[model samples]
Target: MAPVVHGFDWPDRFVVGTIGDPGERTFYLQAKAGREVVSVALEKQQSAQLAAGIDHILDELRAQDGNPYHVPADMPEELRDDEPLDGPVLEQFRVGTMTLGWDPSTSQIVIEAMPITTIDDEDEDGLDEEPEPDELLVVRIPVGSARAFALRTREVVAAGRPLCPLCGSPMSPDRPHECRLPDDQP
Candidate 1:
């Protein structure tokens, strides 16, 4: 199936689809120009081989345009080889969410970026340049480990919850809770 386009403003594109069974799992991304879509689907044991292939393609794209994070001078001797580099290091610099989709026609996985907000703090020294209010600086990472990426993303989101663990009740963020769980304890 063709990807569903989620609505986004100018300079941003929406990518939506599924990695395996479309009904079982769906992913989405809001990407801007020049951002890399790292296919993390390959991180799954069942998808590892495909991930390697996707990584190879992404590496070629990065080599042609020059990856923002990897300066030729900074590359380690071992990573300078033809094989694609691993995914963990790349995850550190990502700016927003990433989703994975598989194209059955080509058997290739599509990785896309999601929109994110940015806050810029004024520099006390006044030497640092300040970004415009509407401007967003984003980094794109192409991940070969989709399962790992998804799990990590979920964990981060879940950590922010104001919810009762025992009863699965929604807790008020503004009010104190009496539950014994550390997250609920007040």
Candidate 2:
């Protein structure tokens, strides 16, 4: 069957949120355009990387001579969205691959998330290949919204289990953490 692309050119909302506790949380990438809403499950690392990637791209754009895009180094206050995910967070798919890019024409950040695909044996070229996913999510937001999205994502990711000061490992609130300290230390 042909692939289904859920495209949101100028979404009203786009953010990353979690549904569970700190130690056992499920991260989701959500996009809403008018009444339509789509959510996709993803790893915490992917969420962090997405935010970092957006920030990196915006920073590079802001550094350009004349700064045509008017990219902001910080998240705009007016665009900040701290509310919880809208509607029931029903995940459409688990994202396996994510791509980010800047659309110069619209001055927007483009984010695409594709579902996980199983790879079969190596092909004639000795390269493991995988089939295309049936569903995908494509969202585009302006520079300010992009910054806000990144900011909110960072906050959501950091809201997880606190790190252990001694071992620098995550400490669960519900259970004790086994801190693996350096041999040189106590």
Candidate 3:
């Protein structure tokens, strides 16, 4: 049996994809309610670390009925029109020393976050301040989906997949020149 770090009703409005390989790691988070998607990429090791971090985040998200973090409405506008928001937030969630490992037996991603101290920036003088901390959340996602997402992201980043360089449309690798219109034919 796969160890379920945490489980919650999969948000009707949320879908996240992650693609990782030995050299690159990419995560894609999409919010159906908001019609937003965020993508982030890191080095191979960093990506693994991020996957680990998300284990905790998924746990937290599942424990709560709604998203706990506050994202400004205007913040969505700041993202590139083509970029998704979920990927970036997931990437940022891992701040301190964190790592992610995959369990082949169960097709699960395991994330671990180490204990570390961070300063609360609420004070005016920028001094370290402590506040009542909330319980940490853990998230669990199926390993198959995670692997597919990671691979898709890597393909996009490597330019190995056929896609419109100008408009970012997924295209055929063998037909790179097919995009030209009849009038624009050379």
Candidate 4:
């Protein structure tokens, strides 16, 4: 069966947002174009890495002598988006793998996310061929929007629960945290 693709080219909005409390948040990557919207659930680390990866790609592009892509050194202030996720944030899928690339023709950043899947023998039909993902979310955003997306992602990630001062682990907001120290440290 072919996978369903929800693709957005230069979407009107793209951002990372979370639901629930800091320690128990569910991160989502949402993109909207006109009335069409797609949201994919992903781990917090995945969100952070995606943002960093985008920045790295943009930085490499800007390093070119002529700066042909016109990649911005910093996110455009006017492009900063601090808004929450669009209401009724329904997740289309849970992301299993994410890939990023540059679209030279359009000078845009391409992001493809594949949904998580479990293959059963019955489902595989005893065939040696690999199975296709149930669905995919593909989004292409211009350089400026890409920069802003990365910036907002970082902020959303940082908004999580504060780390324990002693152990450097996330601390629960509603309860006390028992910090573990090394035996040698007393």
Score every model by TM-score: 0.26, 0.92, 0.30, 0.93
Could you give candidate 4's per-residue lDDT for residues 1-186 as a string of tens digits?
Answer: 878899999899999999998888999999999999899999999999999999999999999999999999999999999988998999899999999999999999999999887778576564765558979999999999999999999999999999877788998868989987977886
The best-first sequence of candidates by lDDT reads: 4, 2, 3, 1
TM-score ranking of the models: 4, 2, 3, 1
Query: Candidate 4: minimum summed lDDT over ten consecutive residues — where?
Result: 121-130
Over 48-128, each residue of candidate 1 has an lDDT whose tens digit, in order, gives: 333344445445444755564232322233322222222222221222433444443432336543333354455455445
- Cα error of candidate 3 at position 183, Å: 52
* Model 2: CA > 4 A from native: 120-127
Candidate 3 vs candidate 4, lDDT winner: 4
Model 3 agreement with the true structure over 125-165: per-residue lDDT tens digits: 64645332222223333433343334443434454344565
Name the candidate that leads on lDDT.
4
Kindly report which residue stretches of model 1 are placed more than 4 angstroms away from their true locations once superposed: 1-29, 32-101, 104-107, 110-145, 177-186
lDDT of model 4 at residue 176?
Answer: 85
Clashes of each: 7, 0, 18, 0
Candidate 4 similarity to native, TM-score: 0.93
Candidate 2 per-residue lDDT, tens place, 1-186, comes to 989999999899999999988889999999999999999999999999999999999999999999999998888899999999986998899999999998999999999999998655554553544577899899999999999999999999999989899988888777878877799986
Clashing pairs in 2: none
What's the true lDDT of residue 76 in model 2? 85
The regions of model 4 sitting more than 4 angstroms off are: 123-130, 183-186
**Superposition error at 23 for model 3 (Å):** 18
lDDT for model 1: 0.34
